[model samples]
Target: LAPMLERTTSAVVNISTTGKVVVRDPFFNDPLFRRFFDVPRQRRERRISGLGSGVIFDADDGYIVTNSHVIDKAEDIVVTLENGQRFDATVIGKDPGADIAVIQVEADNLTEIPLGDSDDLRQGDFVVAIGNPFGLGQTVTSGIVSALGRSGLGIESYEDFIQTDASINPGNSGGALVNLRGELIGINTAIYGSGGNIGIGFAIPVNMAKQITAQLLEHGEVRRGRLGFVVQDLTPELAEAFGVAHKKGVVVARVEAKSPAQKAGVRVGDIIVSVNGREVENSAQVRNEIGLLRVGAQVQIEVLRNGKTRTLTASVGKQLKQTVSGKSLSDKLAGAKLSEAPEDPSRGTAAGIQVVKVEGRAASAGIRKGDIIISVNRKRVKTVSDMKAAIKKNPKTLLLNIQRQRQGLFILIR
Candidate 1:
């Protein structure tokens, strides 16, 4: 263990970040006093500090990998080495969905850790975790791989975690989880216990990190594949209804029109069995499989459709970043594709336009996909056309009655 520690400890780093956040006061916008009394227009600034850990994967190029949450909203980041040397770091790229981030520092005589195959990890294999726990200098703990491919934890959008019993605390985030050979197999990320290690910790697989880091290095952001489809876990009843042989699949709930999935003939109720030759047991697995692929990459999807297995090929599409130009109300609502709400007897579907893709003011106002706009300015809107007509009335502020996940909401868009 000493020899391996000597070989790998240099790659582990202690990360510290500082930033300023606006402290909002409740009286800043007091309408009663604003009419007569003079109010200060300035808001107070509060300094925030955070501590975490990181790994130096590329020593010569000075590329350091860490969790996205570590340096999120950080104005200044500094990475300290095992030898007490520190360097100012700059964020290269980050993927919040995956909780992975890459930062770079210009330094000399740094050490790089050897990357290992996370796919080769087996349960009960010995592993070591190195990080700065609770802001206490560098700490190391040993444990075995308790599980693999753990998901559905709601830790991130895409979760393919490697579970371990290593003592990973709050400050252990983004630290290195290495194999016995001193090869980095994972990045220590989260613990299931209350703010401390309870022998149940999760790590990001090194293979996934490698792919993300490569893309971040090249494009400054990961261009992940988007199939433009919504999926739900396949239940026994759904499997039987879809005539699927087994329940180990995801059922397509909705496919966006004009999307790659729709272009490839994918339809609702199709049971997705495999993606790119990899079997997916649930919607999360499907997302993890396709979300890691580069945009424009071709994926072969095998689905059980109408009791028959069919293969469809699709090229991943990129989400359009639409911006509004004109000042008209229609322009404010432009770039969003809407569809009529699907009928559901169980919930009694609402009469409204389901927001599929949103941009411009609609997105700026926090309108999200899947939100059903039931009324525009108190007038019932059963379709996109009705909503448009109501908006064309040119109200200074549009009050949207929205139904989100069966909950009603009122949002004002100006």
Candidate 2:
């Protein structure tokens, strides 16, 4: 254990961050009332600090990996090496949805930790965690791999966590989770043990971290393709309704007209079993798999429709940029361009017109620039003509079915 610690500890660094937080007085909201009552409207700013740990993966390049939440809203960051050498650091890239970040510092002769394949790990494997637990300096804890592929815990938008019984605490975020050979297999991220290590801690698999970090290094932000369809998990009831033997794949609820999925011949009621040859069990898995691929990349999608499994290839497209501007449309839409909705509807690609612009009454009513107006007054509208016909009825309250980013919701336009 001592020899293993000696080899890996040098690559682990302690991170400290500081920033300013602004606080406004409650009376600031009602200045007139405050003046009438002789109350002071004041604002205050205070300095906040944070501490965490990071691993030096590329010593020669001074590349380090850590948790995004550790440095979030931090104005100044400092990295301290095992030998007590401290240097200022800058953020290279970050994905908040994944809770992972890459930072760089100007240093020389740093020791780098060997990265191991997380997929090679199995249950009952011996693993060690090294981190600055609770800010009590560098600490080490031994544990076994309790589980793998833990997801849907609401920890992050993308979750493929490694569960362990390691002693991870508040300052342990972004620490190193290593195997018997002292190779990094995961990055310590979150703990479900309340305020301390209650024999349950989670880490982001090194495989996922490596992919996200590389993208961040190249683009400074992760860009994902929009499939132009909505899907739901294959529930047992849905399986019965779809006449399938078992609930094994995700069901395509709707496909955006003229979108990539439609162009690839994807349709409603298709049970998607795999993407790019990788089997997907749920909607989130499909999203994550497809999202990792770059725009314009062609992927093969396999689906079960009408009791037949077929594969279709699609060229991924970029997500529509969300801006409050676009070409003008008819008066009924209130100056917004009513076009085909781009992404998912809450109800999985409901028939609707996408609002490319938000002007006039629609803008005033909180109708965002990219909102997809799926229906009006319980009438489904797939195009500008359909919307016009629906508006001609002059319903007292226009109940609109809007799809934004594939989630369905009803918005009332009165």
Candidate 3:
């Protein structure tokens, strides 16, 4: 263990970041109160700093992999090697949905860790976690893989995690989880407890990280594609009813018109046994597999239809995120940018317009980014067209029903 640590620790680097965040006050934002008190109209900002860890996986190209959260909104990033050498780092790319980011530094004689196949990992496999916990510098902790294919933790948009009992804590994010052979198998990410290790930690499997890193390096963002089909988990009762021998699969609930799935002959009640030759057990796994694929990529989907196994080939389609300027729709909505909400297969297409940006009149009317406009003037609006029609019906008053995170509110613009 000591020999392996001696070789691998050099590849694990400490990451620190500095950025600024706006500090907003309701009283300061009020124009009437500001005028009455003669308060300055300038927004306030405060400097912020953060600490984390990273792995130098590509020494030749100087590419380092870390969690996106570690470098989110960072104005300046610094990487410190185990030998006390520091270098300024620049962002190559990031995927917030997957929580993986790649940074690069121009330096010489950097050691790179060997990549291991995380697909080969199993439950109870001996593994080691190396990171800078609590900004305490390099630290190594040993534990066995507690579980594999862990999901539904709501940690990330893609939730296939490698669960371990290793002692991962604050500042350990973006570190390396290695097998006994000193091969990198996972990226240390989240823990079960609140800002502390509670014998339950999760890491992004190396295979998934590798896939995301390749996309980020090539495109600077994860361009997720979709098959345009809805699916549900295959239950034992459904399997019995469908006369399928295996219950571990997903059932196609709906296939969108003119979609890739429909073109490939995917139908409702079809049991999706595998995607691109990899067997799937639930809807999330299917979603993850398809979401990681690039647009125009061909996929082989095997389905169990009417007790007969059939394979279909389909091309992945680019997910459409339509955006429109608020001024195009209504004058009261000026200075806001609206886009179609992300689609959720389980809930079909999302029925609202997401406020991607807000300023001026829209911001003054209490509109904000990330707020979903579910209705306008008491009429439901799902898309830009729907919103346009709703606003046209009632041009005098703009009544917006907004869904902000877990809360709902109403804002009027006149």
Candidate 4:
């Protein structure tokens, strides 16, 4: 039976993408001497390859399933089959927030693997992974399901990842995590190496892949409904801070003016308990569910406010999209952009800034897209208007207290 299962592994393939990008050695578009940033000359573009395994998702046309991060910036992507046929693969669709992407190899009669139900998977379920790990080609590793519904890594913007211990490594970014039947159950995404694997690897559940892939095939992008409310996870101190006996659900710290949350009567200090009928345990879950919902979805969200549970129906708006490198639509600072908060609870930070737009000075200030701006001139800016007003009033020569990477950064807005 094991040998028969081993035979099915041939459908799995390796993916590597190459691309060129412009990067500043010190800073970008600097006023002084105009810093020399490396631009993608097409000639200077490096072979930016990521080692990941993919399952032959379709028997016809040869669709491959892998992590979005693997081929995110690839100017050219190469897919290698188990039977040793390599082809130039085109990206059909990619969900950067979900960390999943679909690629296609132009071939027919390809051997493909079947997909298993991730919703039915349980902890301690045995699984196997086949991928190119550490540049080693087509390696198979095995372990058990460590946990389910894992989140809060900030790895992908939206996450409800399947946690496993299948010996996934850096090269295993987009491999297949299979059930005992050799059916693709998950796409290996991240390794929980606090230092090393400690028995934790994350995979994009097959169910999510199916939905996202369909969207990608339909639209070149993944779109989700955005609930415009700033939120924070409930800490013990926060529970005491809000005078709540239980540290349950995320607390609405701020709501964007005219946002769906504000429009639906959601407010600061409200504890969000459920969305679309599913209970929200933490901020990650909230982000996950919201991301899963289509844009313009009418979702029913429940919140605990003033010691009472109240439900509100909200029509979600389209979430702002960014590039794989994390560049948003606008730039608020030379380094940071600020906007309304999101439904995903994983948004709040220790310093606290609701990052909304990334553009202009923010993008030029060596700041990334989606960064939360917590303070301005040493004063905490809690609302979108606050940051905008402060920046507009102060002009140049201000310090921005930004939150990203779960840490605080003071950027100079000159």
Candidate 5:
């Protein structure tokens, strides 16, 4: 353990952060607010700190890898090596969908860890996790790989994680999950424990991290193709109803009127069993897989329709980027041709409200940015000017059928 610690601890770094942030009061006209408004507030924020661990992936010019959730939303980030030398780091690019990030620092002759093939790992393989757990500095604990090829946990958009019994805790996120040979097989990410190691842990597979990190560094974001179809998991009832031979592929819920799926001759009630040559186990898997394809990539698609298996080659379109990668990709959506709704209380937010206040029930209903309210409770939208007019024609709770870009869905907001 000492030799292992000595060999790798130099690459392990402690992250500290401080930032100047604005405090928005939920209430502005209250007496408490007025009393505090008279006092002069400092322009600079006080020292705020947090702890997490990272590994040196590239040491010559200083590149590191850690969990995106660790440094996400942080106003400032400072990294400290095992030698106590602190260097401020900048966020290069991050993918919340992947829970991985690449940070760069300046150093020479630094000992770095080599990434191990996560796909090569199996159950019962010895693993080690090192991190600044509980902020007590670098700590190392060992356990066996409890599971491999694990999926469907919904930990992130793309998950082929390696589950281990390794001791991962609060400060362990973004730490290195190394094999017995001290090679990094995965990034220590989530833990299912009672404030300590309960023999249940999860790590993002190294291959997934490598693919996303490389793409993010090159383009500042990742781009994938969109197959114009709404899909859901195959339930027992659905499986029986559809009479699918195997209940693994995603069942198409709906196809937009002018979507790529419709153009490609896809229809509702069609079971999308595979893409290219890979089998899709569920709807989320379908989304994740399709999202990995670049725009304009042509691929063979297999779908079960009318109890017959037919293969069709659909030309994939670029998916309007998801919000997880930040605003840099939003320009590819509409090129700044969007407008916000009026903020007057006369136009107070509604369940079917648009252009403002995306939180609450509507967003959970899966309403996303750039979606347009086509109808409220089946009432048709004639024009943008008639949205408020049409809303006044309906009741308090609205059942919005939204048209998001080329796809359509339902959003219930109040």
Candidate 6:
């Protein structure tokens, strides 16, 4: 282990970032008080700093991979090698939805870690996590893979995590999880406990990170594609009703008109078994499989329908952006421009309408820009049309379930 780590530790780098954040003050927000006191309206800014770890995956190109949150909003970034050499870094690209980022530094004689197949990993496999925990410089902790394909943690928009019992803590974000041979298998990202490790840590599988890194390097962003359908987990009751032998798949709930799935003959009541030859146990797996593919890529889908199995080939399509005026939906929602929220394939369904612009009655009702309308009058809405129909049914009273950042709130307008 010592010999292997000696060769591997050089590829793991310590990262530090500097940025600025606005300091909000209610006293400074009052127009009347500001006018009377003749005070300047410029907001206060505070310098901020963050620390984390990164892996030097492409040594020749000076490319490093790390967690997006580590470098998010950073104005300046610096990377320190194990030998005490430091180099300034620049962002190549970042995928916030997946919590993966690629940054580069111009340096010479760098060592790159060999990538391993995370799909080959299994429970109880010996693995080691290397990172700068709590800014204490490079540290290594050994553990076993506790679980695979872990999701629904709400940590990131897309989650197919590799769970381990390693000692991953603060400043370990974007570190490397390697096998016994020193091959990089995952990127350490999150912990299960409150600000500490509790024998449960999550890492982004290296396979998924590789896919995201390729897109970020080429396009500077990940352009996730969609299959043009919504699906729910296949319950035991539904599985029995559909004559399925096992309740391990997802049931097709809705298919968008003229979508690639529709064009490929996918329909409601179809039980999706797999995507591109990979078996999907749930909707999130299906979404993750399809979402990772590039737009226009051809995908083979297997479904069970009418107690028979069939395969369909479809092209992945780019997500559509549709917007509508608030007034068109309802008078109470006036002065707001709503659009379909960006699809999170990990969520396995369309989220809700986003308030892109808010003012007037919508603003007065406590709606703000960037707020997501999860439901209206207790009815779930995924698109502008859905919201319009929901508003029509409720007419007088408007009850909205909104997702504002990381919090959920309800607003009522009568």
Candidate achieving higher TM-score, 1 or 4: 1
How close to the true structure is residue 169 of candidate 6, measured as C-alpha lDDT?
A: 97
Candidates 1 and 5: which is better by TM-score? 1
The lDDT values for all models are: 0.84, 0.82, 0.90, 0.74, 0.69, 0.90
Candidate 2 colliding pairs: 344-406, 345-406, 346-407, 346-408
In model 5, the worst 10-residue window by lDDT is: 342-351
Ranking, TM-score, top scorer first: 3, 6, 1, 4, 2, 5
In candidate 3, the residue pairs with backbone N, CA or C atoms under 3 Å apart (3 or more residues apart, or in different chains) clash, namely: none
Model 4 agreement with the true structure over 1-414: per-residue lDDT tens digits? 378466677888888777865444333344553435454322222345565677887878778878887886788888887778888999898877788888888987688888788878999999988888876788888889989988777676677888987787888888888888888889888887554456778998999888888788788778777877767788888878777787567888778788887888888889888887777778777777777778788989888877777999988887654322112322334334445443344743443455544434455565675576677777767665565566566655668777775767888856
- lDDT by residue for model 5 (11-111), tens: 77877656543332335533477587874422333444567889898888688888887886677788888888888888887877678888877766666
69: Cα error in model 5, Å:
2.2
Tens digits of per-residue lDDT, candidate 3, 1-414, equal 999998899999999999997656677767678767987655668899999999999999999999999999899999999999999999999998889999999999999999999999989999999999999999999999999988756577687899999899999999999999999999999999686999999999999999999999998999999888888889899898888888789999878899999998999999999999999988878988999999999999999998899999999998877779998999888889999874454323345898877876688788987688989999988888899899999898999998775468999887
Clashes of 6: 0
| Residue clash pairs of candidate 5 | 351-413, 351-414
**Model 4 stretches with alpha carbons more than 4 Å out:** 1-4, 23-47, 194-196, 229-279, 300-314, 320-344, 350-366, 379-398
Of candidates 3 and 1, the better by TM-score: 3
Models sorted by lDDT, best on top: 6, 3, 1, 2, 4, 5
lDDT of 4 at 132: 85
Which portions of model 3 miss their true places by more than 4 Å? Answer: 31-41, 240-243, 325-338, 342-351, 354-378, 390-414
Better of 1 and 3 by lDDT: 3
Worst 10 residues of 1 by lDDT: 320-329
Q: How close to the true structure is residue 240 of candidate 1, measured as C-alpha lDDT?
A: 75
**What is the per-residue lDDT of model 6 for residues 173-232, given as tens digits with 9 covering 90 to 100?**
999999999999999999996778889999999999999999999999999998788888
lDDT of 1: 0.84
Provide the lDDT at 309 for model 1: 91
lDDT of 2 by residue, 193-226 (tens): 4788899999999998888988999999888777
